[model samples]
Target chain A: MTIREIGDLLDARVLCGKDLDVDVKSACGSDMMSDVLAFVKHRAALLTGLVNPQVIRTAEMMDMLCVVFVRDKTPTIDMIELAEESGIAVLATSKRMYEACGILYANGLKGNGELHG
Target chain B: MGESLAFHYEVDGGDFTSAGQASVKIKKNLRQLGVDAETIRRVSIAMYEGEINMVIHANGGNADVIVDDTGVTIILADKGPGIADTEKAMEEGYSTAPDNVRSLGFGAGMGLPNMKRYTDDMKIESVLGEGTTITMKVNF
Candidate 1:
């Protein structure tokens, strides 16, 4: 699905990268950047409640297309600028982490695969 | 790239937030060189993890990245307390980092494992109370 569809499905607010929202696909939800790094496949969007520059850096390193902050956790200006520079979109959703992930999952977004044992 | 280009970076151990700067540069450089997306991702992730470890445990270090027609090789060297148990250190969820470091979202004990996961070959050379050096290679 496109990032616009993801935003509509999750009730998310786009915080940055307004121009490229429609170009993204795939999504993964997690607060742990390491876990996200370990498991993210070609997933384009990350659903995270964590707010740190590392979150943006993690998305950049993983080649993710965007990040969604759950529960209305706002990203700092530095984070937004970093996302902008890295070319990853940032969004915020009012839904809690679990519900946001559920909505995306129900709409065909998936985790990279089964978690590593 | 031709002639096996090499890039070197000095990781500042004093600052945690600055840890992944080298990895970011390497990722950018790789992209400019037209390295495949998969290879770039692998190199960046592994180097980022290693860079984090250096800041948290060793204080800081130096990273050297060599890119060639075959693959990419990364060397991280630090003058920090060496790894005591290589086997235990490699275990997932096993960490020697302090609690404060965990608050920063690291110290998850995933660094070493993630490093190994992303690289085709990894070697750890460490001496207690002295320093440590890690060499990892990712083939295209």
Candidate 2:
């Protein structure tokens, strides 16, 4: 699904890169940034409750399409600026991490099972 | 690339907000230099993990990136409390980060393992009380 479709599925608000359209097929939900970094999938977006700038950096490293901040956790201005600079979309939703991930997964996003190098 | 280029950054251990700044900048630099996307991503992720480790464990540190057409080299040096066991630290599920770091979504014990996984070569050198330095290389 595209980011727009994922947003609609989760009732998420685009915090930045509103018009940025990227096809996202795989999704991972984790508050652990290290674990997120462990799995780098193309055309992927992160579903996370963590709000720090590293979340954005982790996405950037994985060449991820966007970061969905669950539970309505807002990132700081610096993080927003960095996301804008990195050309990564940002979204926020009131749903918890589990619910947000479940909605997207139910809507056709998948979990990339390739964990080993 | 005409010649090998090096970029240096100071990691501020006290500032979690700025922890990954160097890796981000290096990613941008490598992109500008026309490094392959996969290679750039590998370099960025490895260095980013090292940068985060510097903040979470050591009280910040210095990062140096040397880039050329064939590969990128990362040297992370820190003057914080050194690792007591490099072997244990390299384990995939072993993390010594404090609870505070865990709240920020780290301390999964994957930092060192991920750094090694993403890079072509990685070396960790340390003195228990003085410091630790990690050297990683990612080939293009």
Q: For candidate 2, lDDT tens digit of each residue in B1-140?
A: 86899999998899887788889889889989888898988898999999999998888999999987779999999998999999999998898898888888888899999999899899999998999999999987
Q: Mind giving the per-residue lDDT tens digits that candidate 2 earns over A40-88?
A: 6878889988888889888888888889999989988888888898888
- Residue pairs with colliding backbones in model 2 are none
lDDT string, candidate 1, B1-140, tens digits: 56899999999999886679999999999999999888999999999999989999999999999998889999999999999999999998999999887767788888999999889999999999999999999998
lDDT minimum window of 10 residues, candidate 1 chain A = A108-117
Best by lDDT: 2
Chain A of candidate 2 compared with the true chain A, TM-score: 0.94
Chain B TM-score of candidate number 2 = 0.97
Specify the CAPRI tier of model 2: medium
